[model samples]
Target: MKQMTRRKWLRGMFAGGGVTLLAACGGQPSGETTEEAPAADDTAADAPGVVEETGSAVTVTYWGSFSGDLGEAEQAMVDAFNESQDEVVLNYEFQGSYEETAQTFAAALRADTIPDVVLLSDVWWFNFYLANAITALDDLAADAGINFADYQPVLLNEGVRQDTHYWIPFARSTPLFYYNKDIWSTAGLPDRAPETWEEFMEWTPQLIDGDRLAFAHPNSASYVAWLFQGVVWQFGGQYSTPEFGMTMLNENTVRAGQFYGDTTNTMEWAMLSADLNQDFIGGSVASMMASTGGLAGIQESAQFEVGVGFLPQEANFG
Candidate 1:
């Protein structure tokens, strides 16, 4: 196996947050005690008991889709936690990416191997909650002395069903604007990005001439849904009810559809691409909408000058 570098190890460790290390005694008698053994025993008494375990050792089997440098960072977190204090031992498992982790947990719940904790994509928390696969941590929170008021109410909210807090908000991401400055300058556009959605739509036409697309992929329902929500809110529309039972597809929905659909249909600004990064790097795409997590990756991979901005919105939604 390839060895993870020291820097990568440190990064992975902090990123994953839950990590552990175990130490072994070398041929010492079972009765013999190390100087710190008493402290370790005391610490173990306070930790949460693992579902599969009979005793104090909390083997928190966590699955995540942390790959590449990010994966290494998570491994480092695991190793650090295991080496920390010997109270909770986190057994890290690489199930695959965020989507894969969700899928794996879905399948695994049918079996005997139920993990104590699982990392899931923030959006997909709904699926887990709907299926009743995740434990409601409200009582756990109370027991642990966590006050919900201490955090942002919106941030703490995972898509709830019927007034039940199914999953505590884990990893979160927001949309962002990514543009190639070189492409923009070459195309004789403004130095900075458009401030409004209308402005952006208008600007797209002048940027593209032939097969080169003004924007990247436009196929992802998730991405489109996000934009639709944001845009509709900009124009004053409620996406879903507080109970989330009914979707309000009013005039705002029609406007959102028209605006988003025009990216490919009317404006011809975007290409129907799955390999957005490829198109961007190849200089075929001038700009794109991507997740906040993609910032570092885009910066590292793109050869051209990349500019970042908040997701484009209407004039006065906020």
Candidate 2:
């Protein structure tokens, strides 16, 4: 395996966190006791994560895709890490959305001005991996004495390719059905989310009023694909095989697409939205599907009670 050097220790720290990285540095046996130390030398000075070698802390530039409430929280983590130790100083820069961040990263790669660490979404990391633009973390993590078994297998495995780990899961989440409880009560419907999209749509008419829509559809540019993937599966279809054989034209997939089109075009229940989050939080849209990670921001911003539940099912549940 290729060694992860130059940026190895820092990468390991980023993959893991500051606390875990530093803790792993003390590899003394459980029963071992401290002994009198010898005088410091060049080898001791050259050790990983030591500032004495360069007479100052190493500064690492990190590019991330987050803003607003999530952005504030991201900065908090960086501040905590910076304050936690003096060996490494994290310099964070907020890039825009995932798409924008990926675009900027591509440009940076071409210009050779990339930051020391760039946060890549799961969907974006594979492209970079195929282009050989990023390094493998297994070696760096191993050198740091990280225990892979300590991580949740499902999440830990997402970054593994051909048995080699690359992109670690950070802020990972899934789409959830979010609704305005106030609207539900006003509509005279059940207090909880419907068991199925069809069931939900049955009462959608009650939700559609003057300026209030029963639901909203984000455009393709706003990550509708991620949400739609679950919808496609719920309709008893698969977008593609594991090996990448697309099945968009498959009967079930087409049915799922038609269902979406009818909501905005035929049924006229849901309208296309530029900012669905704002719409839902502002009470203009009664319901929408969004990431679970949005829970905190929504709770903080919305004045009304927000109810969440599993996405409605259809021919099958995803």
Candidate 3:
């Protein structure tokens, strides 16, 4: 992407943090995507007899994980910024996904070649903070006269550490339910997704049968944690302590575990081993809990009618 002033970009990010999606305490995508356009183009220098101070050109390197069309779109925005003015030259580089970008960043930090700006996923915010590798941009904002309140509190909460802000929120994502509408209707059910947890359970058995599962794709610590969050919250429980130094697997977690175990083992309406994309596309599963980022890709790939709904809510208290 075009080179933007590091301080200036930080200020913009501070004010526009909501544009980026934070990691939904759950991993399912909630149909969120990057919504903000590229940062405003720098004004032309020497316009209308305004004397432009010519100075040494500076190079600002940016690293991100946006591949395919996403990468192309990102580059287009960067190129616009780069060509907007004759001041700083912004250099854009793609380093794969968040994990790959972070790995490259780690190497740069070790070699003292860290870029002028970097895009970080929400989960890594604390890691960078704890490692003391990220630069705080609070005073940078103050100098630029940007208001911080324009951003979402969640973004600020994740970005700020030790009274300073380092990374700016760039892309945000959330998790939601994806269902097969045709299958539901063919199964003699309404052409609608379930709303309450009771309704979901009441429909799963009827919607699924031999050789097909209602749900799939569990077993990862990340996804497991995501699924557990909904149930744990429904049962008034927490996964860890406030300090995040302790795990809190109370009765709620136990109950949640039993519920899931029954679904995959006893009920057989779900698979414990199938990848979500494959099973979802192959029509092997009726519903899936996935990230919002996958929607476009799935839509392009799915052969059957797809529908979306909010995750079901439990009807009864624990």
Candidate 4:
């Protein structure tokens, strides 16, 4: 494996139409492999700059979980790649949600029919690495002229383990505090996001309307833990050491938990929602914490003026 930049890696992965498949086959060859070429159509021959060669174009399957507008965007990218080159043809497959994609990949591993490429979640990619199910892209990236230094340190560091790079950040995001500015103004509260958990709590009472919740907590298994990490951090607690050797179980953790529990169970200020974005957009909740990746869609669908801010901090910890 050799050093490369993240920008070039992304270009090679998408625009350049180059991806090496390393299936999870024990003791089997794990390198670049291509699939049989599909029959070319009139569109292929008509594509600009594409010359019909004697040999069939190399094909590779890519599994991803994007749907809706994101799915459409991904398809457009595949189409552009296929039209740009006559040497390679990309086969795009929609494999459902991230969890479902993992399940399908696991089954494919057992059947020895894994896709050539996959889009994995940040939380789940490490498990695949531990299972020896993915490949190190360092050499391949270097060959593609990737400049690793161009990538943000925190995002690039997520894929490294014991000095080996097994994954690359895609669709990376941080939790953002999203709120309805109209609701805030109507409640006689400041027309801005609260800077701390205490300030947010103080605003909760005014934010509530009849049956509407001041805040909505995500209850889905995939999101609950991710959002809780921010709360735990704000309370001055570490989830676990990077080495995965030890985790803290102190007052900070307890305090964070109690604060959340009180929001719904005692203060009645918040309620759990399976879809926080929808709830906020529908005016059922005043504010909530969600991934920044959803901001575009939320803004497009929302009827009210939407406001975004950094996640509220704890008094001393932040």
Model 3 TM-score (2 dp)? 0.76
Best by lDDT: 2
**lDDT over C-alpha atoms for residue 313 of model 1:** 71
Count of backbone clashes, every candidate in sequence: 15, 0, 19, 6
**22 Cα displacement, candidate 4 (Å):** 13
Lowest-sum lDDT 10-residue window in model 4: 23-32
lDDT tens digits, residues 1-318, model 3? 113444365334333322111222234322223222222224211111111233644455567676767678889987877677665565677876665566676665555555556676654434544455554566556655656676677656656555656645565555677888878888777776677666778888787878887877555633555555656666556666534554466776667667767878887677764367768888888887776766888888999888887766663332
Candidate 1, residue 199: the lDDT equals 82
lDDT for each residue of candidate 4 in 45-109, tens digit (9 for 90 to 100): 11121112335554557787777787898899888777866656667899876666667876666
Model-by-model lDDT, in order? 0.57, 0.68, 0.59, 0.67
Candidate 4 wrong stretches, greater than 4 Å: 1-56, 246-251, 315-318
lDDT of 1 at 78: 75
RMSD of 1: 13.2
- Residues 1-318, candidate 1: write the lDDT tens digits: 112222233223332332112111111101211111111221111223233331644445666566777678879977986786454566788876555555666555544345556766554555544444454444444544555565446755544445544445433566667899997887677778678877877787777868887887544533445544666777666566765555566776567666667778877788776565667777888887666665777788889889888767774442
Which scores greater on TM-score, model 2 or model 3? 2
Models 1 onward score TM values of: 0.76, 0.77, 0.76, 0.79
